[model samples]
Target: MSKPLEITNLYKRFGGLIAVNDVSFKLQPGEVVGLLGPNGSGKTTVLNMISGALPCDGGSVRIGSTDITKMKPHRVAKNGVARTFQLVRPLPTLSVAENVQLSLAFGKKRHWGREARTLAEEKLAFVGLEGRGDERVGNLTYIDQKRMEMARALASEPELLLLDEWLAGLNPSELRIGIDLVKNLQGQGMTVLLVEHIMEAVRALCSRCVVMSAGEKIAEGPSAEVLREPAVIKAYLGDDHA
Candidate 1:
C-alpha cells in the first residue's frame, strides 16, 4: 500500500528572516497540487525543506507513517521523492544518457551498469530525447536541457514529484508541450507539487492550489476558486490579473 504525504508546522529561517512559517499541507495520493506565491513568499523554501535540501527550523514531515523530517537529501530521495530545480542543473560534461543513468543509480530502486543504461535510455525517450541521449547536456537547447532535468528526476521513479517553476520561460508551443508532459505524468499516477507563476498552466494541471504570501499560506482550495481569492489576487496574481 502507498502512503500519502503529510506535512505539519514546517518552518525554515534564514537568520532574521523566516522563510517558511508553520506551513502544513497534505497531499492525497495521486493528486496534483499547485504551490503558488509571489516572490519571497516561501514556496521554494517549503520544497527545499520537504526534499531535505535545507533543514527545517521546526516542524514534522511524514510520508505515510514514516517520519522524514530530519532525513538527508539522498535519504529523502530514497523514500520515494524526486525534484526538479527552477534552474536546470545538468552535469555539463556528461552525455544526456549518462546524467539520467546517474539518477537511476542513486534513485529509490537503484540500478547500475547495463541496467542503469537501459533504464536511462527509456527515460530519455519518455521525455522526447530518445536519439539524442549521447549528446552533451551543454550542447542541448534550453528546452532540451529542461527535458533532461525532468528525465533525470523521472529516472528516480518517484511517487511524489516536486517541480519548481518547470514551465518558466517557455514559449507558447514549448509551454503546451511542457503542460502535456506533466499531464502525462499525472496520467501515469505520479503525484506532483508544482510551484509555478503561470496561471494558465496552474489552472490546467492543478486540481487544488495553495497560495502563499510572506511565508504563510493565505489561500487553499480548488484551483479556479483559489486563484480568484482577493488575497491571492493581491499577493500573487495582482489586481490586473484578478
Candidate 2:
C-alpha cells in the first residue's frame, strides 16, 4: 500500500553551519508539494535527508508508519522513494537505455537481463524519449538529458519522487515541456516534492507550497497564498520585494 511522507523536526549540520534546522512537513499521498526558497535555504538539504543521501543530525522521517530517517539510499529507494538532481547525473558513458536499465535493476523490484532492457525502453517512452534510447547520454542535449533523468527515476516506480531544481536552465519551450511532463507524472498518481526556483512552474504544478529561510520552514499552504506571504516574499525577493 502507498503511504504519506511525514517529516518531523529534521536537522542537519555541516561543522558549525546548520544546513537544515528543525524542518517539518507532511506530504499526503498523491500530492505535489513545492519546496521553495532562495539559494541556501535548506530546500535541497531537506530532500537529501528524506532520500537518505545525507544523514540527519536530529529528528525523523516516516513513510506511513515506517521510520526511514537513517536508511541507506538504496534502502530508501526500495521503500519507494526516488529523486533527481539539479544537475542531471546520467551515466555519461552509457546509452540512454542502459542508464534506465541500471535504475530498473536497482529499483524497488529488480528486473534483470532482457527484462530490464524492455522495461527501460518503456520508461524512456514514458518520459518522451521513445526511440532515442540507443543514443549515448553524453551526446544528448541538456533538455533531453533531463528527460533521461526523469525516465531513470520513474524506472524505480517510486511512491514519492523528489525533483531538485529540474527546470533550471531551460529555455521557454523546454520549460513548458518540463512542466507538462511533471503534470503527466502526477496524472499517473506519483506523489512529488519539487524544489524549484521557478515560481511560475511552482504555481502551475504544486497544489501546496512550503517556503523556507535559513534552514527553517517559514511558510506553507496553498501555493498562491504561501507565495504572497510577507515572510516568503521577503526571503525570496528581499524586504524590498515585500
Candidate 3:
C-alpha cells in the first residue's frame, strides 16, 4: 500500500499576520506535489509547520494516518517525514560522506546504530556524489552541496521528503540533474512536497500542485491547469500572466 500525507485546515499566525490560513492538501506515496506561490505567500510557513519547526494554530498534519501536527521536529521526522532547508547547511569541517553518515543516522530516529560506513557510501552513490565522499563538505559547489542535502535527507530513509526552493541557485544542467534525482526517488517509492519559484522545474517535476496566495490555498489539481489560475498567475507571474 502506498503511504500518504494529509494536511487539514492548517492555520499559522504571528502577531497580526496569518502566514498560512485554512490550507489543506494530501499526497500519496511516489507522488510529487508542488507547493507554489510567490515570495511571502506562506509556502515555507506550511513546510515549516509540517516539519515541526513552527506550531500550527488550527489544523492537523498526518503521514499515513499518523498525527504529527503538534509533534516536535524530531518526533515528526521519526514518523517518516524529512525536509531540506532553503539554505543548505553542510558541516564544513566534516567530509562529505561524514555529513551523509551523520544525517542518515540522526536525521530520523535517535540513530545510535552502527556507523554503517558501507551504507553511507551507498547513499552517497545513490545521490550522484559517489567517489567524492572524502572531500570536505565546504569544498563542494553550490549544486553539489544541495545534492548533499538531498543525500542527507534520503539517508534517513523517510517515506516523504519536503524541499524548499531547492532549484533557486542551480544552473540549468544542475537543475535537470536535480529533477532527475527527484524522479528517481519517486520511482523508489518516496513521496515529495516541494515549494519552488522555478516554474519550469515545477512543470516538469510535479504531477499535481497546490497553489497559494496571501496565505491561503486557492487552487489544487493538475499542475499545468493550476498554473493558469488567476490567483496563481497574479501572485507568481504578475499581471503579465494570462
Per-residue error for 154 in candidate 3, Å, reads 0.6
Report the C-alpha lDDT of model 1 over 163-202, residue by residue, as the tens digit: 9999999999999989999999989888899999998999
Candidate 1 local lDDT, residue 130: 87
Each model's lDDT: 0.91, 0.93, 0.86
Candidate 3 — worst ten consecutive residues by lDDT sum?
107-116
- Residue 141's lDDT within candidate 3 is 90
Best by TM-score: 2
Q: Which candidate would rank higher by lDDT, 1 or 3?
A: 1
Cand. 3 Cα-lDDT: 0.86
Error of 2 at 127 (Å): 0.7
Q: What TM-score would every model get versus the actual structure?
A: 0.97, 0.98, 0.94
RMSD for all candidates, in order, please. 1.5, 0.9, 1.6
Model 2, span 108-176: residue lDDT tens? 999989999889999989888999989988889999999999999999989999999999999999999
Between prediction 1 and prediction 3, the one with superior TM-score is 1
Q: Which residue pairs show collisions in model 2? A: none
Clashing pairs in 1: none
When sorted by lDDT, best at the front, the candidate numbers are: 2, 1, 3
Candidate 3, superposed: residue stretches over 4 Å from native: 107-115, 239-242
